[model samples]
Target: MTTPQWAWAFEAADGTPVEGTVSPVFTNRFDAEQWLGQGWREMAETGIASAVLLAEGKVAAPAVRLSSDV
Candidate 1:
């Protein structure tokens, strides 16, 4: 079975919406979600965009693009 991949969406510090440019990041599938619970929480703090960690071809932890003010 094809393993799921992970991606980190980079964006400006401001709360402006940005285009998610998915690219090669982690070589190991496990590293894709290396952060575990901490990853999602970290992304939420950023607020510019999301850092999605996928597993079993599904989004296990998806950090939405929240307002930076948060």
Candidate 2:
């Protein structure tokens, strides 16, 4: 079986976490990244400020901020 990965979504305006923000377990990083790329914009509109990628339950890297500046 493939390894599992996760992502956490939070409000950028105040860092407040939204409920049901955790993504379904992904089998690979590429799939997880692609999902975020496609959905982050919608999340941002709903108050998601950034997304934190996790590998095996630990942080994979810094959180990705969804801003127009980037």
C-alpha TM-score for every candidate: 0.34, 0.75
Across 1-70, the per-residue lDDT of candidate 1 in tens digits comes to: 6544555554544534356544355546566555434455555564544444444345556454433443
Q: State how far residue 33 of model 1 sits from its true place (Å).
A: 0.9
lDDT of 2 by residue, 10-70 (tens): 5455666667666767888888889888888788787777788888888897889886542
User: Among these predicted structures, which one has the highest lDDT?
Assistant: 2
The residue ranges of model 1 lying beyond 4 angstroms of the native Cα positions read 1-6, 10-24, 52-70
Q: Each candidate: RMSD to true structure? A: 5.7, 2.7
Q: How far is candidate 2 from the true structure (C-alpha RMSD, Å)?
A: 2.7
